[model samples]
Target: MKLTVRSSTISEGEWDQFILAESPWAFFQSFAWGETQLLEKVAVARWEFLLDDRKIAQAQTILVKAKRGTFLHVRHGPVVNRELVNDNLLWRQILEFLAAEAKKENAWFCRIGPLLANTQETQRLFANLGVRPAPIHAMDAEYTWVLRLNEAEETILANMRKTTRYLIRQAEKQGVVVKASHQIEDFLRLYNQTAKRQRFVPHRGIEAEFAVFSKRGQAELLVASHSGQQLAAAVILYFGKQAIYHHGASIVSKISASYLLQWHAIKEAKKRGLEWYNFWGIAPEDKLEHPWQGITLFKKGFGGELRSFVHAHDLPVSPLYPVSATIEAVRKRLKHY
Candidate 1:
């Protein structure tokens, strides 16, 4: 089986459809995501791997300009077709091409976050490619939570934690309401409030993300309200077979509007006939004190299986990469990530 990689010039619909039809679950690798990156001042590109001219895999990469080191970042990507997931040679070839491209662009390294299982064979594959675990904790959602949507609504609610179900019901009885929104500002207002309260920097270009994906009918913003007061909001990315709760925010309130908001999103996903509702990232079960622990408990209460991926790996191109890695390790420790 001959394999070759080339720059992708496919139309946006075709690009997204290929991802939905052929690859693992990763909306970050979707075509609309690249456009969002571009709007955020991150240059992006897409590549397609072909098996004798038949497209088999695709990767969306961004050139991250950082003072520490400018590297090519593959955030949860190089999504391979399920059939070729076990083909080590193809994965190696893909990385070889990406690493070469990074060097040509003067990048210090090529950092990839593949959606492969955290297993022994996966370890061996990256090891053979000379990749080391990245110094930063995660490039994206390396350990995510997902709830399958094929079950009956009663069953789904029954499976959730008792407290979660109670909270959701309480919100409903208290007259909390969730509605679909086209306005990004509605979500952004709450999102910004959350970032400040949590002492974390909110990501730039969420508006751009909403615009790009919403234009394609691949996104929705859900807002939870009571007495016309916006209590909580969330942005759900509908990609592949999942409706992912990718971003969220809420004001401090005694009411359990956030819980109701999540339930609303799940029902929306089920209404849309999605296969899963992805809760995005959670702290590793082993790291009880990680930054995401609180929210992790919140997400876990909704009832879902944990999906752990091999950590992001760095394929070094320049000797400066080692220095950059050292600095990153220090920063990660300081952040407790």
Candidate 2:
């Protein structure tokens, strides 16, 4: 079969529709995500792959330039048609195409975090292509906690940890109220405070992200307050059939307000006709010392199945890649990942 690839200037609606309808669809692969990256001064490219002129796969890659070197990051992609993904030849062609594109962009390496399950077979597939595990995650979450929203709210509550359930009830008894709004000012105030307390760098593109997603009517800010004081907040992104708990922050409070906030967000997601609620990112059980450990425990308390994606893989395209890799490796170690 003849393989061909080409860049598309217009939005590939057919491609997105097909991919988003598939299982494991992620917001990063959506057309709007590329636009959001553009607002952050990052370059994005959309490509379509064909086998005998039949569309087989598509991907949107974000080119990120750092002080050390540039790299292409493909998060939760390239969304391949189910039938083509298993075809060895198709995978080869896709990687070859990505490498060529990376070379053209002067990227030191290309990183791919496909939405495939983390299994031995999946690891071998990428390993066979000479891809190595990346030092750090390209997206915030490599493993996520996802809840199916088909069950009744009571059933959902019953499935949660007793502590989580009690906390939610306690928050209510303590007069905690969760409010959903489009305003970012209030959320940012709490977000900044959370960052300060947690000692992590806040994402610099949150404003641009909110602006883009809100314009599409696909985002909401949920804040938990008690006695007229904000205690916790989150920016939830509604994409396809899933509601993503994208960015969140909370201050130290004794009111259990965060629990109420999460429960409220889940209910809001169901109200919007969403079928899934993704509590994005959690540390693996073995990585007890990982920076996300505390929050992961908090997320797990709500009761959801753990979905582990294949770790990010790197395809080195330049000699400078090792330097960047070393820096990333050191950073990961220092962060206790």
Candidate 3:
């Protein structure tokens, strides 16, 4: 097999073509993510592995520069077109290419947080490649909750947990209404308040989020109100056959009626013909002490199957500067940033 690698700067058409033709993981590997990485100033690197003049594999890696050093991260990528991802020759070429790129940039190490479904066999593969699993990054975890769109709305409602369906009905009975809007003020108000309460920095200010929504056809704001008073709000993202619950918040008045608001968002997404609803992240099932106890319980009540990804893993790119990688990881962990 002949192999050659190059930095990828493909057109969006070519990129999405690859995404539509490949598995779910391929979407993340598309150039769209690389563009986002550049916009976010995350120092993105892309590589394509070709064989006998045919494009066979691609990967998109992102790096964040910190006081310690540059910390590399690959989001849900290295999308290979092969039937099985375990082929040694292909893996070897990709791994060598990544290490070389890291070295060229003087990066500390490359961390890969794949959205691929997790398994013991996959873990062993990473181990074979000299990568070690790091502690999980719960907030960045990618989750997809699937709601069947083929069934009648009533059947879909019937499949939901009793209390969930009850909440939707109650919201209707109580006259809580949901609206989709592009108004930045209202959405930001709810988003900022929720972030403060939840103890995480909001990813984007409302204006910035609106700009993102305008460019990417994937996101929207859903606000639920009672008598014109905002009670619950959600920020949803549509991407590659999935509707993701990217962010959401609620006032005390809407707590009881909030489940219905989410249900409505799911229905709206389905009506728009999206394939899946991503609840985003859930605490591990085994970790009873998870901080996400409340939210996880609520998401599970929606009746989506439990799915987990391989915990983030990293490979040493510059063996001479291992301390840089350690310090970078520590700073991110300590800051809760």
**What TM-score would every model get versus the actual structure?**
0.95, 0.96, 0.87
Which tens-of-lDDT digit does each residue in 1-337 have in candidate 1? 6678888898988888877775557678888889999888888989999998888889999998889989999987788887787787888888889999999889999998878898998888888877899998764778889999999999999999999999999999999999999989999989999999998889888899999989888899999999999999999988878998889999999999999999989998999989999999888777766788899999999998988889999999999998899999998888777
Clashing pairs in 3: 218-238
Q: Tell how far residue 73 is off in model 2, in angstroms.
A: 1.2
Model 3 C-alpha RMSD to native: 3.0
On residues 1-337, what C-alpha lDDT tens digit does candidate 3 reach at each position? 5579887777776766665565463345656556655666667777777888778776778776767667566767667674646676677677777777777888877766656567888777777877776543444655434554666677778888898788788888898888887875787788777778877677744455445555777678888888888978887866677777867787666446578778888888888887677787776666576566678888877777766666677777666446764664675567542
What is the overall TM-score of model 2 with all chains considered together? Answer: 0.96
Question: Model 2 over residues 309-337: C-alpha lDDT tens digits?
Answer: 78888899999999999999898889887
Rank list by lDDT: 1, 2, 3
- Best model number under TM-score: 2
Cα-lDDT of candidate 1: 0.89
TM-score, cand. 3 = 0.87
- lDDT against the true structure, each candidate: 0.89, 0.85, 0.70
Question: lDDT score, residue 169, model 1?
Answer: 96
| Cα-based lDDT at residue 140, candidate 3 | 62
Tell me model 3's lDDT, rounded to 2 decimals: 0.70
- Candidate 1 or 2, higher lDDT? 1
